[model samples]
Target: MRVVADWARQESWGVRLEWGLAGARALGPGSACVVVVDVLSFTTSVSVAVERGTRVLPYPWRDGGAAEFAAQRGAVVAVGRRSVSEQQPWSLSPAGLRRAPAAERLVLPSPNGSAISAAVDGVPVIAGCLRNATAVAGWIVRQGWGTVRQPVSVVAAGEHWPGEDLLRPAIEDWVGAGAIVAALARSGAGPLSPEAAAAMAGSVGITDIPTLIADCASGRELADSGFAGDVAVATELDVSAVVPVLTNGAFDDAR
Candidate 1:
């Protein structure tokens, strides 16, 4: 095993924030809990599905293999947002998931959020989004995770460039992560790292987050692709009380 500098790990703080897959890897090892923020879709969809009592298995890739993985688990696999149809409605879109019939389990795949969630190991993984940010924070505190002895890492699962490996550093996910960090701070769950504090501060001035999110690049892309309702569903701040925590290889309501 290669030794990583403690500085890179943000080891001094109770709560820390980082971006994308590399971020999750850098901070995940020492964290008591890692909150995965993918506000535009993956985490948001998990929130919606878990709220409706569905266990969501986050598949790292949205490829043909996802169906096989779901089939092995006897779970319904979610298709792409634009692929939802009359016979098969479940997709990465939160609004679509909300409208889909309740199932015992679902396999939701994504290149960003689900990839991050699937990569992190050992520590408890909690899905955090705009709709359940406060709830997720409180649950982390209740689990005694956000303390100096047992730190928490908040990871923003940013989007990838089309057909590219480059991360987009999505504003919506940054804000979503900030919302959770802010809530955690309010609950006295942190001696937050500078990065975490910055995330919280970033969320402090967003007085019109709904409009800001809707007008953002990812949001506009989804809107142009006819998934505008997904954006609307994702921007509903703190409306959900469900905290979806990954347990036994799947996300289920922990609230």
Candidate 2:
């Protein structure tokens, strides 16, 4: 299978775009898995929720007007942020979500992550982050979907335009994607693209892991907003075995 890594919409080739509801609409249906990466926190949040055994209903902040739509269907609604802040209602950590009652719905508002989830349509969607990289990759490989025919697209939910200097979010995603690529390679799946190879190679040699990512643009923004802990929480690898699969506008554990 071919792994296409899109840094952003405008920077993507063949089929890729930056984070937006519009970019998500362009996703075509094929034997492909859409791996959405909002590593700074959103994907991290979804991964946590799945790990805790709660069904997540991801909606665009605007469509939150329809939150009742999901609640009626027995799913919890989570809204993220448009900017960084620790005061947000739900924490992006597994322990936090686990502490909440299963019947409770979480409304989240995030700058980038939720918007990307809202935009995608059709195809099997999966949440991506360093914390769940191995589980996700192993699941994909076990599906036995042969390469060259089955395509895997890793979408990076980057910051809004003009605020693109936040390298942490993208770097976190690249590292996660690299880890996935490496896992796929071990299965003798296929060859890695130069970008994927670089991501894998780049994840090495960071003395202070938390500080390395926290210093990135997104990390700094979160830190300044008092959500620095979220960045540190988001960057950890394999914290949970949950693999959240986007099915019909809600997130369910990938069996």
Each model's C-alpha lDDT? 0.92, 0.59
For candidate 1, list the clashing residue pairs, or say none.
none
TM-score of 2: 0.74
Off by over 4 Å in 1: 1-3
Models 1 onward score TM values of: 0.97, 0.74
lDDT of candidate 2 over 28-112, digit per residue (tens): 3453666777777778878876766666666554454645765576644443433223443354443345455543445444556
lDDT of candidate model 1 versus the reference:
0.92
Best model number under TM-score: 1
- Number of clashes recorded per candidate: 0, 18
What would the per-residue lDDT of candidate 1 be over residues 22-102, giving only the tens digit for each residue?
999999997898999999899999999998999999888745699899999999888877688877789888888888898
Estimate the Cα RMSD of every predicted model relative to the unseen true structure.
1.1, 5.7
